[model samples]
Target: MLGFMDYVQKCFYRASKWDEDNSYANLNATARALLDFPTPKGLKMNLSSLSSPNFATSYSMASLGVVDGSVSYLYSSRPLDNALNSGDVQLKDAVSGYRDLREIMKPDDPRDWEIWKGGVRVDRRDTLLYGRMYLPASTLEALYLRRLAPTRQLKISAVSNSRLPNGGTILALLQQDNGKWSTEYLYSTDVALIGMRGLYNFGFDPRKALPRSTTATTTALDPRKIAGRFSAGAEVYYGILNKSGGMSTGFRYTTLPSNVGSPLTVTLTVNPLMGHFQASYAVKAGEGAVFCSRYDFNIYSYESDLVLGCELWRRKQGDDTAAAADASAAAASGMSAGNIDQTWQPETTSFSREGARDDVTGVLKARITQNYNIGLLWEGRYKQLLFSLGSNIDLKRREQPFRTVGIEIQYNS
Candidate 1:
């Protein structure tokens, strides 16, 4: 986990405080949360700027698209962060960016981390180039190019103006071996992907047959796609790697405000991940104001697992709210967006009035194997700052709960 975190900092050139000395422990505990899942619906923009003796830059990002129907890409100076500066020492006789085995395992060592990343994908093929330098310890990185060509496949498209379902099958030889423990698969076959909704990905290692790896994901699209109304879908995933695996399923619903005074837009996703559910709603509350709230729940316990976040955007002008509403409607309807003024963009122009979150989360997992089963997590975030409290509880016996706490502060700029 520490190695991964260090890689991320090196990749982004320490753009935020993600690599700060004190944040190490916190980053370790909440690594999973830091790797966020894509929101079921909507678009977001994030900007960060920094200037100091060591680094300086302005970064802007915008994300658009869906999981299966569209393309997603990022543009930034992240690829340049891992290079060594003029004054940095070039340690002699180092291996893989490390001077010794101890350096490779030490999370708090003050070593200059080097990382670089760049990638582009086209359909079934992808090309990636990356470099990393873990000064005084090891220098590690790789460049990879891969493609998935289905040797045999069949597809039946949905019939127009008919109730016919769509489906396809594929038999593909995969050689996505990057010399890594993961991504070292040799072949894949579609056990099933029927009705344009069901899915199955069966993978094989040249040496194993019971199937050492498999991934099954299914999504049932909303039967009806309508504006200003509920549109819902459910997704399920069952995956296995070697002997351990997990199963999870969830449903998502989206609603767009039908009228000027209705809510701006909202999405509620239940069970987005293990034992978790989330609801995010944003609205134009007044002429120049927008209010948004996000709430999340875990089936286990929430005093330490629940997260409630709220944001208020104070517009520069009274008409800003109306403009934002119009722009949103236009974008959603596939209308020409040229009429929308860039100045009216809420994420770009609105002044943040307030932003904070209340989070408490924990889980009580029941282990029911052929024989038996148990879990606890706590996290908090106020604006750009975060803290976590973790514990393990063994209810079967009266024992003291093992506990830990960590804090992290991140600045967009």
Candidate 2:
């Protein structure tokens, strides 16, 4: 019994102030909370270090369309650093033998997450289909077929449009536009990453945090606040998102503000190595100071010095990523974009993403993957922003929760 209890304790263990130095330990607060159980009073469980930083590699080799590589490094940080996860000395050295490792592990890919993405998403009791229209139009220095009416732009976003679902769902990025160069999410949701994310995305499971409890479902979200995925509905989230880390925030008030539903839901999304496959994450706050991550995709035009882009950013939800190709056509005219930069695009074409996940104790395991995607281009006059659409495809366990193909238009200087 002691051994069993010890194992349980280790599985759901929380970190102390000292261990907080580690990023992996810092963010696992949620994982630990969902796993925390009880012991005799005044007792502490000393566990052997489960420090095998999770390693992920693709079984296939790089092919014509599919970029092949391996991700053997384990990232263990909360706050992002210069390189993140593998940037750690131990992880970098560990992966050195696999020369192609760098090609497979990328932080900026829509599906790739060097250490971790934003947060987890929830599941609808029924078939949930979320559709949104994200339009970014700025007549400043924008371009499009409506160059005659240069101030026109619109967009739409959907989540789980088609499915016969029944599996542990992990929602990463679903779709994206383009940034050329940058290190932010498809939709930036860092605006309100604290409570909003803490309550809904991961669900408010108080049981795991309770010293005496081992299960997670019995706990509840804040009764007065109208929290949890089942409780809230969609609205609009906004803020500024750029390189060097920026802020993004918004709010959502639910249709039915309060209910006693399942309070624990963690979607274990896998990152596709192809770098273009997109996934979205719902944000959640950590134990200490609250930090946020947003998912996004934008479609914008740059005509002259005027730049307009349609965007969808879920402060804790996710964004749009659609840029216009013709944005550079009018470089000599007043509609020409002098200097608009795209610094968020990923470095390579491959990646391998995986992580250990535990939801309500029954399903506590790993979500490993190696995926690839080709660019989605529709340059004719798809919508606005000079259309060329693409997506990230995650190859993981039982769930394939996303598919993206869109039209775009752009007007450049």
Candidate 3:
């Protein structure tokens, strides 16, 4: 009976194949990340610490004298034995090595890489609970996420503030992902809104049986041979309180990442209810540079705007090859392997590149609009802290060219 049950489980896993699908909300994630990189305003500082493998806390203070803090707890069904069962240096080293290897073997997808280097890992099917509170205003925010199965997840997020109408808002979402498509249903307290969204990929489906031909098998194994993945999705929402309804449709095409060159992603979204259209194109210009542009248009108003942005990475010379060597040498020389984790501090203010390479010294991001508004941001590590400097200017405003300037500092342990 046990053997029969195990066979059934294996068959079910093979049939589901939930890993390939992407969330419907992420249809234009690549373009949004490149074009909407946040710029800090005024002075801000953040500090975070990991008390244990499952618990973490953070604190922040802004220039306006506002203070906020947060705590997060993670629960994994199958937690890493080495990370949870022991605090020994050897165990920590083993766990770190395993994580590094996993990252190295991760698929080279253009959409996976972010601007930050390292952070806590929350595996699939894990549960996370988080809460934050802000002083003075006494605003509270909370989030909960739980994976009920390999293919289904539930998420709840809420915010409460005295200044907000009806004491803020709450949202709940149910998400499901199959190998070829993804879907989501959501409810929001504001306006008693309910929505549904779905995405379908018109590419290869892993759940299908493999072909017998050698050439077909080889082509299937190499995703780069394919031109790109085309996906189409739509979302509709209805508000019970407001007695309103709206809908939008989106399409995306993204080329697979390749060693020879970077990939490209293009997306288009249309809102028939409002006669609004948005299109964006993003591409990695090279190993260290990326460029993106977005256009917004409203047919009824005959209004349009264009925005362009770029990001550049500064990496240390020979740091990529030397990083592993240096780590090995440090371990051989009796240095604590745990200290090695400190060398790759995660950036709190910007997206980080995802991979084994940790040689990035700084990042520069700039954006400009058709209206002559310009923004610049630079993020880098200073000793044990990460810092970001940003400024905005308007060419049209000759009297006040500098619109805003700010700096942010962060530390994690």
Which prediction has the highest lDDT against the true structure? 3
Over 312-338, each residue of candidate 1 has an lDDT whose tens digit, in order, gives: 222224555566676697577643333
Query: Which of the predicted structures, 1 or 2, would earn the higher lDDT when compared with the native?
Result: 1
Instruction: Look at candidate 1 and tell me the lDDT of residue 64.
Output: 30
The list of candidate 1 runs beyond 4 A from truth reads 1-226, 229-242, 256-305, 314-413
TM-score winner among the candidates? 3
Per-residue lDDT over 1-413 for candidate 3, one digit per residue giving the tens place of the 0 to 100 score = 01111122222222322232265677776666566666777888776554554555667777744544333333333222222111111111111000010001122232332334367544344565667777656788887766566567688999998777798999999987764778899999999999999988775664554454669676664433555678899999999999999999999877652333566778899999999999998887755777889999999999999999887878889875687686588557634433422432321101122333446677787889999999888877666666778889899999999988888776655
Which lDDT tens digits does candidate 2 get at residues 90-143? Answer: 221111011111100111232322234366533211111111111121111111
Cα lDDT, model 2, residue 251: 26
Ranking by lDDT: 3, 1, 2
Q: Model 3: residues >4 Å from true position, as ranges?
A: 1-21, 65-125, 215-224, 258-261, 319-355
The Cα RMSD in angstroms, rounded to one decimal, for candidate 2 relative to the true structure is 28.0
Q: Cα RMSD (Å) between model 1 and the true structure?
A: 21.4
TM-score of each: 0.28, 0.17, 0.74
lDDT of 1 at 198: 18
Predict model 3's lDDT versus the native: 0.62
lDDT (C-alpha) at residue 6 in model 1: 26
lDDT of 2: 0.20
